[model samples]
Target: MVMTNFLQKRKSVRDFKNKEIARDSIEAIKNYIEEIEKETETVSFKFYENGSIIYNGLKGKAGYSGVMIEAPSYIALMKKDEEKESCLNTGYYLEKLNTQIVNLDLDSCWITLDNVDDETKKNLFGAEGTKVDYVVAFGYGVGKKLFTPETTSGRYTMDQIVFKDEIGNEISADELETTGLLDIFASVRFAPSHKNSQPWRFVMEDHNVVLYMEKSDEDSRSLVDMGVVMFYFEEMAKTIGRYGKWSVILEDQDKYLKVAKFSM
Candidate 1:
């Protein structure tokens, strides 16, 4: 299946059957990880067959807020350099991998490892400078991979999340349709965020899309969330014959943190 089809059909599966992913699927995941590592130099991944170690730490963890789900296998994501860009790259890279997993006829859920104990961190990926950002559980789900109304998991509509050339001015669906970006923006709206905060806002410039984040005083996981949305935007754009690359902009640092500009 194409990435766009998977994007529309995929739902986060919290329950999985007691079965292993096919060896070929595992191989495909590893190969894709290698490619993503090359593309995003700061990110790295490791796969674990035994989910008990990670699952145990997730139990009653405050950071994860007791929402971690169990599965037969897990993928641990780590970053080499602890910088702002590294966090963004972590989300960007993992979502790409997640999309690939969906395309492979598998199910996955992004599991937060923020509150994992020290010992488990040491055992899973090591306790060095490598910062473990997140883990994903993947396997055959207990049911079908269809997006029901309940599974759609409501997101902020385009008017609420996107803007017209500036902040506060909501962009209408009709305007997006006229620009041939309605579908592309729709995919961005579906991108998952920490706590479903949906903290991103896009400013539609002439033939370009400038990304921004809602105001926050402290360092945010939402930066990672922004990268995840960008991944969706770029991939869906490509699938529909719209191509562009993201470039960071430095001018708009006051009203909002200028994340990137997608140039067509």
Candidate 2:
């Protein structure tokens, strides 16, 4: 399947069959990770066949009750710096991996490591400087289910999340339709976030799109969530031949924190 279609079909799977992934599929995943790491050079990933070590340690953590789905394998994400940019890069890289996993006919769910125990961290990373950011549990799902955009989880509408040239001025669907950005904005609207907070805002500035995170929603994980949304936007844009890149914008500080700018 094409990248855009595969991305649209992707959904969070919390259940999986007790089956190991094919060696070729695992190799493909490793190669893809290596490729992305070389491009970003800001994150590292480690795959573990045994999920029990991380799963058992997550027991009794808030918001994880009955939500921690067991799988045949898990991929641990790590980074050296604990700064904001590092967290955002972590999310960006993992979402790229998730897209590749979906294309391989595998399913995954993003697992938080905020409350992960020290021993579990040691067992997963086995290093000191690099900090664990998140984990993705992936494998072949137990049952087949057809998915569509409507079947996915609820999300904020484009108008609620996107703006026209400035914050508080929400972009209308008509404007997006006229500007040919509806599809790209739709992908950002559906990007995953912690508790589905959807704490991102975009300003359509000429040929560029400016990304911002709500000041109140600012946190380590939210920065990562912004990166996820940014990745979705960029990927969707690429499908339509709009090639651009992200650069941090640090001059603004107020209601919304300027995270990055997409220069087209």
Candidate 3:
């Protein structure tokens, strides 16, 4: 499952059953993190609440009942200080780990700086230069009310934000449906961004997918935001069972680029 399908399946799992996480799932998650770390060399994992409250702090709303007792357990993703684009790398790599969790049939929701507990954060991650850019909460659902009309309505559509070319050149919602790119691109629309900036763009050069970072976009953590978007496209390809590899490409234009062209 890709992150969007997982996102479609994902709900704010507020009420959770008191079930313990399976050992195999735990190992799988750890192993997945290890694999990513080996490849990207920036991801680190930490557990909280035994898988119940993965992230807490959304403006001091640490939902977990126990400091360590609230949820089953939580995983905190951190980027190493040495990595050049650590934050962006963290987002991209973590989403890959996240999607796999969904493929395993688990549920989770991403959290920003506001929803986590600062007290334990320093211990879970580091207090200095090592920043915990993003957090995700995962666990078994308790059959609780997932979303309100306001929440679902808030999700931005392709037309509302995405463009056929650039930010101003808006593409019609109806037109997007008929295009073959929708299934893959629509998933990018759902990929999480810091403060919902949606700081990503795609340039299709024949069979290549050129990723561009608009001027305002700052890859504070290396291409972490771009990584999140890449994760969406990767998962979408897999949903259709499409196989491909990604790489960094450069364009001789005014804008900064983080290209990940796919090949069949």
Give the per-residue lDDT of model 2 (tens digit) for 103-157: 8889888877666667656755685413775789899876544345665667777
Spell out the clash pairs found in candidate 1: none
Please give the CA lDDT of all the candidate structures: 0.76, 0.76, 0.60
Give the CA lDDT, 0 to 100, for residue 162 in model 1: 83
Per-residue lDDT of model 1, residues 1-264, tens digit only: 655555666588877888878989989988998888888777888887777766766566522347667787889888777676776787788898998988888898887766666666776577651377678988988865435557667778778878888887978889888877887777666667776678788898888888987756534587788778888888877876777878855344675778889976
Q: What 10-residue stretch in candidate 2 is worst by lDDT?
A: 57-66
| Backbone clash count for every predicted candidate, in the order shown | 0, 0, 29
TM-score of 2: 0.87
The per-residue C-alpha lDDT of model 1 at residue 170 equals 76
Give the higher-lDDT candidate: 2 or 3: 2
TM-score of 1: 0.87
TM-scores of the candidates are 0.87, 0.87, 0.70
lDDT of 1: 0.76
